[model samples]
Target: MSFKTKEKEAVGVPISESWEIDFQDDFDTFNTENWQDQRIWVNNETHCYVPDNKYGTREVSDGTLKLKVINTGAQKPCDNFDKNGVQHPDTQYVAGRITTKNKHEFIKGKWTARLRLSSNGEPSMFPAWWLLGAENNESPVQEANENVCWPLTGSGEIDIFEHHGDHQKNHYTTGAIKSLGECDKGDWWSLRKGFDVSLNEYHEYSVEWENSDLVYRVDAKEVYRNVGQGDQYPEKMFAILNFAKITDAPMKGEWVMEVAWVKHEFRK
Candidate 1:
């Protein structure tokens, strides 16, 4: 296994004033006009994605959005299903996943979210801040144009922040996922980089196009760059926030990822 990461540090990116905010949500409340709960299984992720804050899996308070993974301690019936219409098994874990799929999809802009975990990373916790192509053909396919499958023309993905708690605390990986020209065929580690950061505190995670290249940042500071890979994701995309339980290991209490805000910016 080869490594595709950089040492965490600020490399400096010139602040551009020519950009203006295009969309924003400060999480004054869980506004259905801008987002919707997404309950589909794809990653083999262990927890069931639930809606309506069932078991306190999602909450908005103090002007922030909290996506949580709650341990119910016993199996509960789940309504989440896969793309093939197979229902998820009754689960001991329930979590929240939200997306802007049909609400705020846009192309060629800066995406940013200020968020943090409630505690140090622990086993099985998988929290993410990312974007998926609007035309993705997963469950809840809402339109005729939304038929593109994964890693294809309109289904490419970009992860701005992902923490694999099974690895280490205070760390995350961010970058564009390279498409391999077929459904579900994508290179996840090629253009991505894992970085050390304080997970228990808020930091702005972001990805923006620097011409044809892609720039990844933490708190408005550049940390990594994937040269000329931005061309693969030209389709409109939308944001997502979710806390997943990815392993069978039992954990105490619950895990939380808090978001202060999410926004997009475009050239003026």
Candidate 2:
């Protein structure tokens, strides 16, 4: 399938005159000042996030950001371990993960991105574009947090788009996670009709956050809406893009998630 080019105008739900573009990236090049190359591991993932281009972690070319998952036969030492307390002497896979942790953040706005994921169905390759509250304990922005744990207090998570390679060609998921009773039991909320997005074609995924509700859309079409739980996410959040290896699906070479651009507009 052919790739789609970037659009000249913003392609999302029409904004009122009061809304203004606050943050945008066409990805003409890798802007180090706006994104951090996160290398820490979590969630029992198999790949180690690295900044090296040779490992197929991050690449910017022709106005696009390519976050790739690659297999390197050589064993690379890693300091982090999974829940089982098993140390990873050497990792066979390396991938990309970048976040706007200490850069740009917003409380209520319209966040959107245009991207296409790798069509490789290896079940292990997981690609996602999501947001996390700036006050999260793991947040690189130290000033935003006041000793708060994850998914509670000032920390929340919003999954704008996520794709599992094992699913159908046009299947994906989007949802929100809210803290409940100190993160011990959080609520996982999702759309009634989960996302069915084409893997090889570019599409726009977005969330319109307001005081009253959170509306999720794909290509400007409303897919889901949450009205009552919007108050739980009062703190500002930052963006994250990554491709992780989470399963035993045998991988041959590489998997890529190409991003054309990302934008955030807020109401004045």
TM-score of each: 0.93, 0.86
Query: What's the CA RMSD of model 1 in angstroms?
Result: 7.3
lDDT for position 72 in model 2: 86
Q: Please provide, for model 1 over 120-209, each residue's C-alpha lDDT reduced to its tens digit, 9 standing for 90 to 100.
A: 578888899999998999977888999998879798899999999889988899988888888889999989889999899889999998
Off by over 4 Å in 1: 1-17
- TM-score of model number 1: 0.93
Top candidate (lDDT): 1
Clashes in each model (backbone N, CA, C under 3 Å)?
0, 0
